[model samples]
Target: MASTVLIFSASLIALFLFSLTGVNANAGSNVFSMQSYGARGDGLHDDTKALRDAWAAACSSAKPAVLLIPKGKKYLNRHTILSGPCKSNIVLMSNLMASPKRSDWSKETIRHWILISGVTSLTITGGGTIDGNGKIWWQNSCKTNSNLPCTEAPMALTLHACKNLKVEDLKVVNSQQIQISVEDCTDVKMSPVSITAPETSPNTDDIHITRSRDVQVMDCTIKTGDDCMSIQDRTENLHVNNMVCGPRHGISIGSLGDHNSEAHVSNVTVDNGRLYGTTNGARIKTWQGGKGSAKNIVFQNMKSAVEVSDVLFKNIRGTSASEEAIMLHCSSSVPCHGITLEYVKLTVKGGSNDVRSTCQNAEWKKSGSVSPQPCSFKN
Candidate 1:
């Protein structure tokens, strides 16, 4: 009896050890070991097949699929499309290298190296770099010399129609267009994202969220050419917090247009942000004849350096053309309401008005002032 008891205890211990080993194997850094399916780690080899196979294997198991790029350099000559009805989380973790340029912008065609579309419950978290290798593309735009229709093209990371998405701890630099774009997505969270683009790079808005709902963007540093963050067309339940924006227009809502699709943006809050050298600190710009509404929006605890206005509303119809910062150029059909500003401090180095709003039923009540404004300005 004593020998049998001892034997049972030993068997249990062995079983536990085996289970631990299996877990470690499955959780092993999911590192991309090769450029192809069978090859070893040679930077020159194309490891796309290896990455796909690893993801397939992890997906088959009920575990998170981590497509680790490791520490070195991996090149992608073509677009990586992440289309999903995936059961497990897909992660692209790596210090990826941009594809080599063939020629000038004429032959430059690397669109969306990391494209995540039609996915759900995906989290892209890593401390790595995604370089767009955008020098040649920027040169092409400069050569064309046209400004109206900005020549910059598709973005580096495009998340379209994805839900429950989380993108964090990534450094994106030198992208041809927007570094990260979230469109028609819901329940998304983007945090600790650092993006850098040349101040003169046209149409390089760091993050543009459109037609999305229940989104949160926090703890980000965005330096770009266009609006650092632009929310347009049917974005609701949005929250932006603890951000730094520079070398571009500050946070903006709309350029909402006429005859285009219309959506409501409500319950949006932006708080605890710093803006430097931006065209406008906080702005709401709508076109002359759009059929949409912006409401329940609040800006709190925002500081701007060298901003055009602390708060601006350009409602062309209600206020004088030059008097409005929150412009409501919308046709009589569309209405704008419930826009609020609270606890905002701004320093406008250039000479411009401090506050402007022109929505028909808009309300502005805050305890802040511009340097040269009169003491009795209120709305």
Candidate 2:
């Protein structure tokens, strides 16, 4: 009886230790380990096949699965997809690094490094790093040198057509282009994520949201070459709060309606954010001769005339890199109205605190210690 009790206690202790490794406790023996599938994880060997095999086993399992790419080893994967409408909920805990050699990537996959699609009720929470190893691609870009041909570079992580997804506690860095692309997804939440790249790296946006709805991004730190977060056409019900953005373009609503295409983006909110040393604090850009409407947006910092209306900017205080701290460049074809600014303050960077405002085809109201004042409504 005493020996049986000691064995039982040891089993419980082992299970408790296993739970701390980020695998689901309910997953039990359904943990598909990449190493068990023959991944060397030595940073030199290609782990793509091992990773795919692990995913396939877990994705087909009738029980809840945890695809474990365990820690303390580096894994190199080529352009890979962990695609599924799996039988049960899945968790991917990984420390995946992309192959840096241009020869390793095929032309078809030059646009994406790691693609996760069609998955539902998925959780990707590992305090692991997804390194793009992008310097080789960046060196050959047209933006690096005009003499080079403009070619497509890969986004480090692309989550497409997924619903009820949660991605948290990951560090995604050094993509050849966009770091994280959330496209055609719904009910997604990303929090406490770190996305970073060199400011001189071209088009490396931290997070790009497009055609997704009911998405929330909270407690993120983004410093990148392009927009820290760019909300594109048809994205609605997005909430971004408690974010720190810097050293590039700040949060942007659009370069929407490009090529005369119809774009519609609405019901967006950004609150409790800070922007420092950015090219634009908060901006909206829609091309001329484009058809569509961007409305019902609230930006705490700060448009386009995709018919922008019913928007509010509250508690936006920052140092502007441009002399024109507030620019409301609305489209004349469809003017913007019902804009509000409250407790706004902006001063020129590396200069006197004085700044100016510019407005065209926009009507706005201002209150509560507004500096640089509202356009055509000076105190």
Candidate 3:
């Protein structure tokens, strides 16, 4: 019978040449490959429905999409939300491996394991590795246990209200809390990001910016257990360049007018920093009855202890192992204003070079070398 019509016409021309080599879609070359939307990337299954079906086919593709999580594999997202303004421009690259100990976390699905919200134009680059297995959530911290339930330990990656954001490089490790939380975002730009944890790993803060603005935090290399970078309370126009803070708690701007509230941080700048074995070198901390105003603050190289003020501490040197090496703790009624101390050198460890500095109602002025000396903020 004509050889059964030439074997069903050669199996319909080999299934039409395998759909022309499959999945390029060919409109603007949309590619939604999370292992072809099934992802058994072998970091232990449950690849979050193959990363939520490749983020809904590259977010409802109108083209210019590429949602690939390829490269040695490790996709195990929990509280996922890669929602975006996607009809164009998206290239979420990954090797994301943070599974919150493979499920069973309460309190709203463990807070925020990965929430990339309301995006406009996003670019999350990858060398790959985002694991926040954080030693079983810091052994289920109550942060000291006041009858339990203190820290639910979340935040592995959060960019809420996302605008034009870009997170590059990526080697974020061990974060059970505060690994990267950029809230209410705007033109955000992070560079060569690399954050690690465990200097004790309690409140693991390696970068936590709040109520964001035209921000830029570059060349980041943090070693954490708390505040390698924690700029809080209605931030605006911040820029901190080339940082490498240490064993932890080196960089901080305001435990911010806490409970009393009403805080507003502005026009901040920290240039070329490198603090090691830190405890406090350059600092300003407020909270006596906060209202608003931490103006044009600046830190040239290294240090901090925290508060909010009009700071300009140039060429700041470091070395503080506690007991006042330099702690300009201000705020009786918002007193720290335009406090500029140039070429200040700090030194105090294992006590007694007689190194001292402790002021209240702090207000300052000292040019070139305010070494081991800076007391009177005079009540």
Candidate 4:
């Protein structure tokens, strides 16, 4: 019988070639387009050549690409460098604005409107608005640098050495210095990001994660003047959760120094945070002839209202610290070890102490009502 009609026509031609290879892999995975390549949502000038020609057609392909600035208000005069070896995934939706420039202040150079370098697996989510107009970089860094160094410019989303980064639901505004600087990055995940400036904005630190590691900053809302989160150099496996810092300088770790640069901030954890009118709530700073060492840090279930020092650990010598909460002056060749504060609940209306250590195997114990001056255990 013609071999049963040639085995039913070869099983209907192999089921129509497996349904055309699943619709050609969903049509190359639905690569969304804003006029095929070149986007613009006119709101009033400077679209930076249609957003650098839609990020060069979304890094010219390797899959994921959705540069849809669809909602309105798009303006930017200078600085938008996203140099990368990106593998795809860049989505910036909702009222996008990267505006700045009045000749960008005589071009002295420090402009990083949206610079992301050496990326790998990048993702910048929606609810957008990145306006670092910064009053012309804070009136040109207070007229000619005023003896330069630390807080004279540069920063608005500068992520260098990135790898597997993810920044969610953005709303960063008026940044001059340190709005979001994730340097030496690795597997970073910043969630629900909402940072705002101008509480006397100068060196506006909202999120400065340096020498990074497997970091995770969650449920964020940072209002700043400085140090909403400043974990500087040589960091490791850090985690911060349910955060909401204010008027600035609340969560910090180290001003650590002196060549060797050791900062094994092991399994650090800051949870259920909410620090308002902050000037210090949780800190572990090191300086005063510098050397290095900060290990196994933890601050849990935090809540500080009207702070001026719910907790501050400092060490001075230039960088504006004459007196202000927990100042530790370590010298005798570098010493500060194993800092731990558990179940902390602080409230300081007028500055002073909650906990201050001079570092020699420091350990601060807490369960509540800590009134400072007690931690000097070095046996």
Q: Against the true structure, whose lDDT is highest? A: 2
Highest-TM-score candidate: 2
What TM-score does candidate 4 get on C-alpha atoms?
A: 0.29
Q: Which digits, one per residue and each the tens of the lDDT, describe model 2 over residues 209-315? A: 99999999999989878888888999999999888777677788888777878989999898766664576667678787777888888776321113477888999
lDDT of 3 by residue, 242-320 (tens): 8777765667776667677788889989787766556653344667666677788888844333334567778977678
TM-score of each: 0.66, 0.74, 0.29, 0.29
For candidate 4, list the clashing residue pairs, or say none.
Answer: 314-328
Which one wins by TM-score: 1 or 3?
1
Off by over 4 Å in 1: 1-60, 102-111, 142-144, 147-152, 258-261, 306-379
Candidate 2 Cα deviation (angstroms), residue 323: 34
Candidates 2 and 3: which is better by TM-score? Answer: 2
RMSD of each: 20.0, 18.0, 24.6, 25.0
State the C-alpha lDDT per candidate: 0.61, 0.80, 0.71, 0.61
